[model samples]
Target chain A: MTSAFALSDHDSAQLPLATELIAVIVASSGGAARILTIGGGDRLPSGPLESRHRSLQSGLRAWVEAQTRHQLGYMEQLYTFADPDRTGSAPNVRVISVSYLGLTRESQKASFSDAGWRDWYRYFPWEDHRAGAPPLIAAAIAPRLSAWAHGATTAALRRERRQRADITFGLNGHRWNEELALHRYELMFEAGLVEEAHRAGADLRERAGLFGRPMVHDHRRILATGIARLRAKIKYRPVVFELMPDEFTLFQLQQTVESLSGRLLHKQNFRRFIEQQQLVEETGDIATETGGRPAKLFRFRREVRIERAIGGTKLPTPRS
Target chain B: MTSAFALSDHDSAQLPLATELIAVIVASSGGAARILTIGGGDRLPSGPLESRHRSLQSGLRAWVEAQTRHQLGYMEQLYTFADPDRTGSAPNVRVISVSYLGLTRESQKASFSDAGWRDWYRYFPWEDHRAGAPPLIAAAIAPRLSAWAHGATTAALRRERRQRADITFGLNGHRWNEELALHRYELMFEAGLVEEAHRAGADLRERAGLFGRPMVHDHRRILATGIARLRAKIKYRPVVFELMPDEFTLFQLQQTVESLSGRLLHKQNFRRFIEQQQLVEETGDIATETGGRPAKLFRFRREVRIERAIGGTKLPTPRS
Candidate 1:
C-alpha cells in the first residue's frame, strides 16, 4: 500500500537532479516586436539552476542580468518541461527546464555585443495579419498542410488533422485567434512542416525555410509560449506598458499594441477606447516626430493598477 | 558565464532527492461541493512520487486510485511548490511538492474507510454569500482582521494591510469577488488569524476558531488554490458537468455551480445565458424530483466543449 505521505529515502544519493532556466525576454522596437537572443540570435538566453540562488525567479533574474546586462521588469513562470525526450536522446537522464516570460522596454544602450534582438514575426510570418493574411499561408503552407492531412493513414486521422489545421491556422474562412501562437507552432511541428520537426526525425528537408526560422533546441516553441501569454495577457492586464516608453504619443502606443498583437486597430475607435479606460493621461507635452501635426504625449496612470481589475482593451476590428 | 544548458553534477549521488504529490480531488454532493481527504480528514490524500510511474500525472492517478479506488475523470496540473519551508521544519532538505486539481463525479460506492468527502465551506465559511454574508464574517473575522491591521508596527503598514483586507474579503463597501478564494485564505494566513499562522510562529492564539478549521499542513492553502481555479474555470470551460449527475433539472445544475462558487446566481438570467450558449439540451424526460413541479431533464451538450471557446457564465448580480 503506497501512502501519499511516505517519506523520501533518507539516502538522497540516487535522485536525478538536472534543472535549467530558459528566458524569453520580449520587447517592442520600431513598430516591430522582438525577443532577446544569445549566441548571435540563434538561441534564447538560458542557464543552469544554480544551487546558491534563493528561488527560481531570482535565479533566472541573476542569470539573465549577467548575460544581457538588461534588467527584466515584468516576469512570470511560463511552463516547466520535464519530458525525457525534451532533453535530447539521453534516456537515463532527467532534466527539468523551467521557462519564464519577461517584458521590458527596448533598450537604446548597448550592453552585450554577442546578444541581439530579432523581430518575432521573422520566425512566424503567417501570424502577422495586420496587412491582411500573409501570402505564404494560402500560397505555400496551407497546400502543404492539406497534403499532410490527406496523407494520414486513416480517413479519421486525415479528417482530424485537417480540422486541427483549419481551427488553429484559421484556414477555410475561420477567423484567426491571435492567442493560438503556440498551438499553430505545435500543429506545424506535428505535420512535419517546421525545421525543428525535421531535427526531431521528420523528413521535412524541403519544407525547411518555407516554414519560418527555427531556434536552437526548442527555444522557438518557448518564444511562441511567451508570445501567446503576452497576447492573451494584454487583453486583460496593463502589461503592454512594460513594453512602452515612459511617455509617448497615442499613435505610438497604438502602434506598439498593433505590432505585438499582429493586428491592425481602427484609429478613431482605438483612441476612444483608450480615453474611456483612462489607462493613460495627457502629459501636456507634444511630439512632432510624426510627419504631420504634433500629437499629445501621454504617460500611464500608475494608480489605475490598484484601483480595480481593469477590463480587457477591445480591439477595433476592421469592417468585413 | 552561465548557460541555460549547463549540466548538473555528473555524480548525481549528492542531489537532494525529495518529491511529493498533493492532490485536490473535488466532487459535488447534494447542493454542496466537497473535497476528498484522508487521515481522518486532517490532510489531503497525498504521497511520495514513486519512481515506477512513467509520468507525474500517471503517478498521481495511480496513487489516488490505489488509495480511494475511484477513477478520476478530468485533471490538470495546478502549480508546483518547491519552497523548502513547505516541507515542514526540516532545514537543508529540498522537497518539491507538485499539486494537482482533479474533477470527478461524486463516488457512488464507498472505497477507503479513512477517506471521505467534506464540504469545502467547512474551511471557508466567509466565502459563501449565497444567503448573504456568512454571519461569522461580520460577527468575528472582520473585527479580528481590523485589530491585526491596527497592531502593525507602522501606520503605512497598517493602512496597506487594511487595504489588502478590504480588497480580498470585500469589506468596507467592496463587492465580493468569488474568484479570490486563495487571496482571502492568504490574507487570513498573513494576519495570523488562521491556525497555520501560529505554527509559522505568529502570536495569534486568541483569534483561532474565529477562522475556519485548519488542515495538518498547507493543505488548506492548496485546497484554496483548487477552489479558486474551479471557480474561474467553470465560467469558460463547462467543467461543472464533472460534478453533476447524468440527468438533472436546470435548477440542480445551477445549484451545483452556486455551491462551488459559494454565491447565488440570478436564476432567470442564468437560464437565459445557458440557453444562449447552447450548453445543454432537453432529454425529453421530466424530472419530478424537483419537488413542486415536474421540470425538464437536460444533459450537457458535450460537443460545445470542442466547437468554440465558451465565454464565462455571467452571475446575475443582486440589485443593491
Candidate 2:
C-alpha cells in the first residue's frame, strides 16, 4: 500500500496533464442516420478541455454547440480513454479523452464543408443490416475475416480466431446481434482488416476489400461505442425522439429507428408496440409528403418520462 | 471551438495530476450485508494510485488484498469522479477517483480491528424494507422530510421537493423502488437530512436526528453509487454468487438477495423465479442447518455466463 507521498515523488503538486473531449453527436435526416463530423468527416467532433468549462459534460457540450450551433438534446458520458497509445500524439504527453454520446434533432446548422454530418454507415458499413446484411458483409468482410482467422500461426490460435469471427460477425449460422457494433469493429481491428490496425505498417495493398473509411485516430471506434449504446438504449428508453422532428409520421419514426438500429422492424408489430407503450400521441396534423398516402403526425408524450424512469420504447427485437 | 494548443495557453503540461482509488467491497455474513471499511469503519479502504500498478483495477485489487488479505472477485468500475469538490483534499489538485465495486465471499480474512466489513444498513437504515418499512421512516424520517419539503420558500419548490421525496422514498403512495439507493441518498443530502449536507455548519444541533453515520468524505456517496449499481445489476446478471460460499441452500440464497436488495422477496415466488432462470444447479447436497427441515444446496452454473451475456437471475421483484 503506497502512501500519497510515496506514490508521487515529485512534490505531489505538479505533473503534466491533458484532457480532451470527444463527442459522437448523432442525428437523423432524410431517413438516413448521420453523425456530426469534422476534418472531412474523418474525425468525430472533438476539442480540448478548457478551464472555462465547468465539467466534462459542459466541455463536450460547449465544443459541440460551438461547431454546429445545435443544442445537444441528449448527452451521456460514454467512456474515458487514458491509454498513452490511444492519444495518437507525443508519446510522453498524458492525454485523457472523455467521450460522450450526444443526440439532437436533425438540422442543417453547419455548412457541408467544415463541420457537418456524414452518414454513420460510411464509417461502419458492416453495421447496417437493414438491406439484408448489406452485400459487403458477404462480398468483402466475411472472406477477409475467414482468411484472417485461418492465417493465425498455431492451431489453437486459429480455432480461437475463427470462433471469435463467427461470434462477432454472426457467421456460422449465429444470429446477427445489431447491438454489437463496437465488438464487430474491434474484431475487424484485431484481425488487421481495418485501416486503424495498419496505422504503423501500411504496406498491405490487400486492404482494399477490408477497411471502412477510417477516422483520424480511433474516432470511429468511439463512434461505434456510441452507436452500440444508442442501439441498446433505444430498446429500453424513448431516446429515438431526440433524433426526430417535433412531429413525425409513424413511417418516418420507424425509418429513423431502422436507420439507427440497422434493422428493419415489422411495421404492424412496431405500430402496436408503440401504441401500447403510449410514448407518442397524435398531433392532429398530417404529413402529405409520404409519397403513398397522407399519414398522421405524432409527437412524443413527454409526460410519460415523469411516470417512470425505465420506460421502454418497445422497438421490436430484430428477427434474424 | 478551442484548439487543443490554444486551450492550453497557461502551461497546461504543469497541471497537477492526482489519481485516487475508492473501493466498494461488499459481502454478506450472519444474514446481513456489509461493506469493507477502514479508518474505524468510517471510510472505505482506498489509496493513492501508484505507478507500480499496471492498471487502475490492479491498483484497487492490490490495495484491498493488502488491507484485507482477501482475494477480490467480480470487480467492475462503478463510476469516475473528477469534480474538485469531490476530492475534498485541495482546490487546485486535479484528483480523479475511479471507484470500483468488488465482491468477495464473506470470509474471516480480516479481524474486526483493522480493515473490516460493517453492516451496510448502518449507513442506510431507511433503505431496508425487508420486514416492511423501517420504523425509523415514520418515526424519524417522514416528519423531518415533510418539514423540509414544506420549508421551501416557493410553492413550486415545495411541491417539487415533496414529489422528489415521494418518488425516491416511495411517499404519497408511490411504490418503493429498491434499486434507487443512490437517489434516496441524494434526496436526503439535498434535504439536509444527512451529515454530508452540513459539512460547513455546526450550529444545527437539530441535525443530530437527521444524519446517518458520516463517512470521512464522499465515501458514503460512492457506496450509494455501488449499491445502486448492484441493485440494478443483480436483476440482469448472476453477480450474487460472488458473495456466497461454494454451495448454499435456496433459503440462504434468498436471504442474501433480500439482504443486498433491502427488500423482502416472496418465498415461493422467489423459488419459482430462481428455478425458471436455471442460474444455479443442485449440488446433490442437503444442508441440515435449516431450522425446520433439511434444504437442498445449489451452486452457481458458471457455464451460463458463456452461453449468453444477458443471463437474468430473475429474483422476484419486490412486492411493494
Model 2 misplaced stretches (Cα beyond 4 Å): A1-15, A67-69, A139-166, A200-211, A309-314, B1-15, B66-68, B111-113, B153-156, B202-211, B268-272, B310-315
Give the number of colliding residue pairs in candidate 1: 5
Candidate 1 residues lying further than 4 Å off, grouped into runs, are A1-14, A108-113, A153-155, A308-320, B10-17, B108-113, B151-158, B309-320
Candidate 1: give the clashing pairs: A4-B46, A4-B47, A46-B4, A47-B3, A47-B4
- Candidate 2 per-residue C-alpha lDDT over A1-320 given as tens digits, one digit per residue, 9 for 90 to 100: 44332445544323355677899999988878999887768787777665566666787788777766667878887877666567566655556677899989767666544678889898888888888888888888889889998898999778777776777778888778787788889888887778887887677644543457887788989999999989888887888877888899998899999999999888888898889888899999999987888999999886665544532244685544
Comparing to the true complex, what docking class would candidate 1 get? acceptable
What are the per-residue Cα lDDT tens digits for candidate 1 across B214-268? 8888999999999998887887677887887888889899888888988888888
> After aligning candidate 1 to the native by TM-score, how far in Å is the CA of A18 from where it should be?
1.8
Q: Report model 2's TM-score to 2 decimal places.
A: 0.88
Considering only N, C-alpha and C atoms within 3 Å, which residue pairs clash in candidate 2?
none
- TM-score of chain B, candidates 1 onward in order: 0.93, 0.92
Tell me the TM-score of each prediction against the true structure: 0.91, 0.88
